[model samples]
Target chain A: MLSAEEWDILRLSLQVSMVAVLAVAPLAFACAWGLARGRHPLWVLLDGLVHLPLVLPPVVMGWLLLLAFGAQGPVGGWLAEHGISLMFRWTGAALASAVMALPLMVRAMRLSIEAVDPKLEAAARTLGAGPWQTFASISLPLAMPGVLAGMVLGFARSLGEFGATITFVSNIPGETQTLPLAIYAALQVPGQEQVVTRLALLSVALSLLALVASEVLNRRMGRSHVRD
Target chain B: MFEIDVTLRRGERTIALQCASAGGVVALCGRSGAGKTSVLDMVAGLVTPDEGRIVAAGHVLFDSAGGINLAPEQRRCGYVFQDKRLFPHKSVEANLLYGWRLIAPEQRWITPQEVYDLLGLAPLLHRRPVNLSGGEAQRVAIGRALLAGARFLLLDEPLSALDAPRRAEIMGLIERIRDSLGLPMLYVSHQRDEVERLAALVVEMD
Candidate 1:
């Protein structure tokens, strides 16, 4: 019952959220690890900075991104010299989504990682595991369920991201107009209630799917150890 | 061989210990909170001593004045913790081989099969750490340590958490390991009879 334009919106939204979650997962995990384990006073600052997106107005986050990643901005200028740019592009939309999702992902992952017994890491060390090895073999696997949950939360947040994305990338149909932006655009017109309803329903469906998928993965992760 | 002269400062307490041994099982006998586990931690390089010299397995594991302190991974010390810190996510077989597989072939002195046989761990191999009984978990913990190509062993009250029968079983296994492998061990325990039965030299710590 959806038009080709609506189909394009759905596809673009999925692509943006997927890219955002994948790109943010590793860096978010690192931030989570630092917040969980680092004792240095500087970690307090890092923790605040990482969670800044969660507390700040999304429009403000979008504005900050625009300043730092706009073509005239320093990083953007350097990237432009390298034949790359994120200004008003779908990649820019993904960047906005990623920034908005980071804090939620980090918070969930951090709690999981902190819950991991430090004694186990010490044991790994005595068994000849270096810090990196201990993290990979022990810490990461133990924290997998929460990490997965974080990713799902990030994906959901990215899918729903609107204010930052619209501010950073603008509503360019077929380029940067994702599901939320599309719904917002539809809401601006009279007799577009049909379009808004369909889009909103699709958003809820996608979120539910993500939650169910995470729950299934979580159960499987927990069962993997008790295979006997 | 082990030679340790270390001073550590805990909150509101200072622990000073000096001990030397020509190998075999050198037991550190002390009551709870007497810094026995801390001493083991220092030797394993898990904790740094405020000031000390530690020589283990012919290596200067730590020397404060000489400015030498090995990392835990480099110490080649098989530390069996009292809680039996097996990776709960891994099978017993995987836990046993976790360190064994990391060592270079040339550095490895024992085989996984031998560790399994010595500890009677073959049957428990497929089980996870959560499924193992107290004694069985301790055995797997010991086997895991032994398979890591340890230059020496550090056991911190490995028997304290088990029931009487399980404790006796593990005691027998410890004796077997001591006699057969002849690896140097820094065994920590507060029980006098256990120390007397297993230790070649008893160093009392307060």
Candidate 2:
């Protein structure tokens, strides 16, 4: 029951959030693993930086992203020299969403990694595994449930990301207008309440589906871990 | 042959131990907090000693004065933890083969079939660690260690967690492994009977 424009918004939202979660997963895993296991002195600082987006106003984060990744910004200028741009682009929206979702990803993953017994890792070491080998064989597999949960959480957060995305990419109808932005746009126009309702319902449905999927995945992983 | 002379300090506790083993099981008997496990951990390179030297299998595993400390994986010492510490995500067979896979082909003398037969693990090969009994888990842990090409084994109270019957069963299994493989072992325990039954050399600690 959605029009072509509404369909485009839904499709773009899905694409942007997917990209955001995918891009954030690996980095989040590395950070979580380090925070959970490493004894580096700078871990406190690193942790603070990772969680900054979670506590900061979304608009502030978006502004920081713009400053760092806008065309006139240092990093953005370097990227632009290589034929890349994030300013007011869908990629910029994805970047903002990813940033907003990262803390959840890292927190979930870190807790999971921490739950894995270090004694088991030591046991692996004594059984001929080096650091990397032990992590690959033991730590990573045991922490998989958390990593999956983190990804779903990140995806959900990305789906609802509005302030950072709007501030960074603005509201471009077919390019950067995600579901939330679309709903917001529909609200600004009087007598477009029907459009707003449909979009809002779609967002709720998408988020609920994600939460259900995460629960199913976590249960399956938990069962396998228990059986093993 | 194995030799260790180490001093470790953890908080206010200081554990200083000196012992040497020519062959057979060398039991480190001590009360809790007496550094029995700490000694084993030091030899396995899991815990670094403030000042010590550890030599095993004609190689210097650690020498604090000489600035030489081999990593745990480089020591070729199979350590069986008290809790078994079997990989929960892996099946019994996979856990048994965990260390064997890392050894160089020529160094891998213990075959999977031999391990399965020795530990009576064949029946439980496909089962996970969570499904196994305490005794079963320890047996798999032992098999995993032995197959890793360990020149010697460091067993930290491998039988402490089991009941009397299971303890006896594992003790019997340990006796068999000693007889069959003849690998030197450092067995940590506080039990007098275990020391009397299995150890050829006893290193008593306070």
Candidate 3:
């Protein structure tokens, strides 16, 4: 039984995680494709950059984002001039979560894209399909199972995002205080053990639900891959 | 029609080739690894030759000297590989129509109904490639290429993957396509009988 304030925290966390996953999915897909198929030296450089967040401490990632996207920072200052600001905002929380989720998403997607037979793409090309059309019709559909798995992993990562979100956007009730932050806040207060337990359970339930749903979706897509 | 003079460097071996054809079934007969498939790839724009000129159906697909190289999609060549290479995810109908919808209506010489009947594809439309037999899958692959408005076709040992009965059946189908459809083909096969039975002109390779 979550209290009204607790419910607000849950809702905000969902909103932020959902926004993060949506915002980052298409970008992550492009990055994955580049890494999987690109033969240029720059692609190797991009591979390292994409994996940086996965290896670096989340706090360092947060600090870098702050330096680049904070109000006084270069991109942030230009954005502020246009009446848009991400510092200390819920959107900033989403950006933090998205950055944290990227490497996991891209890694999953790239493996699947690489597994696609290039000969099939060649066949499509001879059948009057252009590069983009071939990717959409053949490569993308063949990679759906892995792409869905990546989204699930990304969503779970975004939902649990803490260090980066806390650093980029300070915990503010109903704004940036997601599940982990709310639990931390409750733990700091005396006699608030029950509140912490409830929030923690909710987080576990959400992650479990994502895992089960992704399993079901993957089975359906896997039928096509049974022979291959 | 095809006129090709190409040179390719493959590891230590250098493949130098020259051929001219007025079109129909021009069989490229060679032993395994003789670069028969590589020639088809060059014409399809999948593999670039070191220096070459390829003219197919009166269109110059590649001419290194003139800097004229068209992309695979622009060449309008139907390529049926040894493996058939049917899209695993799509149903037979979808796979059949995948390229058909890309061609403009006025340029579309073959209709879906005609292809379905020609290839006996109607019965397999609802099934995916994974469920299809080798012969059925090969038929769908050919139907797909035809529906794409291909000006010419390249068949790379198209019957090499089938059993004896299936081979005979598909060979018959190929004869019908050649005699009825009147489409020009650059057919590749190592089998002497297949070449003798299907090709009007046979070019030997080492």
Candidate 4:
């Protein structure tokens, strides 16, 4: 029931969101683990920085990202010299969305990591597992439910990201125009109300599906964790 | 011979313990909060003594004066906690093999099959720790430690969490393991009967 252009936008949205979630998951997990376990005094500062994106206005966050990652920016210039340019590209949209989704991912993962019993880690160490090995074998697997939930939340947030994506990478049709951008573009023109309505419905359905999937996965993990 | 003379100060209380064992089960028996667990933990390298020395199986595990403190993994002391603490996400086989895989093949004294047979764990190999009963879980924990090439085993009231029958069963199994493996062990318990039955040396603490 949709035109080829609409399909392109939808597909691009999925691609960008998936890439965003995948790209940021490892970094988010590391930050979460550090916040949950590390006793360093700097953890308070790190925690605030990680959650800044969640509280800041999306436009402000987008502007900050542009300042740090724009072609003229220091990091961006160095990366450009290496032939990797994120400016005004789909990769730029992914970067913005990844930043936006990072706080949600880290929060979910931190709570899960904290739930894992430290005594279990101690037992693993007694059994000859080193610190990294214990984390890989015990902490990571036990916190898998949280990790999965975080990933789903990140994916959903990335899918719905509009303000940051728009500011960082303008809504160029077939390039940066994702689901939310297309919906916004459709709203600006008269008699495109129907397009907007369909896209809105699709977004709600996708978000709902992600929430339901996360819930089901979390429940299963909880049951498996309950002792015999 | 195994020797431990450690001093740990926690707030207003200071626990000083000195004990030695000559190649058999040695029991640290005392009331709760008498630092029995602390002594075991210090030997396992989980808790560092403020000032003391610990020697087990000819290895100087800890010497505060000499500044030699080995990490828990490097200490090679298999600790069976009171709650078993078997990895919840891992299967029985994986839990048993968790440490076995880390040790060099030449250092491995006990094989996986030996552990499985010793603990009667053949049927529960594929089941997760969540699916195991308390007694079964303890057996798996013991089996896991044995396979890790433990030079010495530390059982920290491993049977306290079980029922009377299960406790007796595990006690008998512990005696069997001690006899068969000939590994020196430091058993921490408050139960008089448990110490009387299994320990060759009983170090009573207040």
Model 3 stretches with alpha carbons more than 4 Å out: A217-222, A226-228
- Whole-model lDDT per candidate: 0.90, 0.89, 0.89, 0.89
Q: In order, what DockQ does each candidate have?
A: 0.58, 0.66, 0.73, 0.76
- What is the lDDT, from 0 to 100, of the residue A183 in candidate 3? 91
Sorted by DockQ (best first), the order is 4, 3, 2, 1
The best candidate by DockQ is 4
Candidate 3's residue-wise lDDT over B24-112, tens digit each?
89999989899999999999999999999999889999999999989999999989888888888888898899888998888699899
Tens digit per residue, CA lDDT, model 4, B64-145 = 9999999999988989888888887878898899899988898799888888888899999999888888899889989999
Report the C-alpha lDDT of model 3 over A24-140, residue by residue, as the tens digit: 999999999999999999999999999999999999999999999988899999999999989888999999999999999999889778878899999999988899999888899
Chain A TM-score, structure 2 = 0.94
* Candidate 1 local lDDT, B106-185, one digit each (tens): 98988988888888888999988888888998999899999898999999898887899998899898888889988899
Q: What are the iRMS values of all candidates?
A: 3.5, 2.2, 1.6, 1.4
TM-score to true structure, per model: 0.95, 0.96, 0.96, 0.96
Model 2, range B44-145, lDDT digits (tens) per residue? 988899998999878899999899999999998989888778888888888888889998998887888998888898889998799898898889889989
Worst 10 residues of 2 chain A by lDDT: A219-228
User: Chain B TM-score of model 4, please?
Assistant: 0.97
Of candidates 3 and 1, the better by lDDT: 1
The top-ranked prediction according to lDDT is 1
Q: Model 1: residues >4 Å from true position, as ranges? A: A215-228
Report the alpha-carbon TM-score of model 2 versus the true structure. 0.96
